[model samples]
Target: MTKAMLLLKFAGLEFSEDRGGYHKAPKGKLPFIDDEGLMVADSTSSVFT
Candidate 1:
């Protein structure tokens, strides 16, 4: 999860840090991204989105 956050940080992108519960994840994943209502759960997909 830190790696995903680091990826966003290193890219100079602004992302929200949600200290939410793990039980609410889309696919039981730790690191996911929400962009304009679009959900990104995979690490690879997030990089391009």
Candidate 2:
């Protein structure tokens, strides 16, 4: 979660932080964002998948 926020900051992108938990997350995964109403789930394990 912190890593995602930091990446957004470092990239100079303006983003709103949502504190909703796993149940409200995309596919029940953590650290995500709604880009043009698309639920993008950011997971490090995706590389392994």
Quick one: best lDDT, which candidate? 1
lDDT of 2: 0.68
Kindly list the per-residue Cα lDDT of model 2 for residues 1-49, writing each as its tens digit.
4776776777798889877688767778777767667676864442223
**RMSD of candidate 1 to true structure, Å:** 1.8
- Model 2 spans with C-alpha error above 4 angstroms: 43-49
lDDT of 1: 0.79
Tell me the TM-score of each prediction against the true structure: 0.73, 0.64
CA lDDT of 45 in candidate 1? 77
| CA RMSD of each candidate after superposition | 1.8, 3.9
- Residues 1-49, model 1: lDDT tens digits: 5777889899898888887967656788877777777877887878776
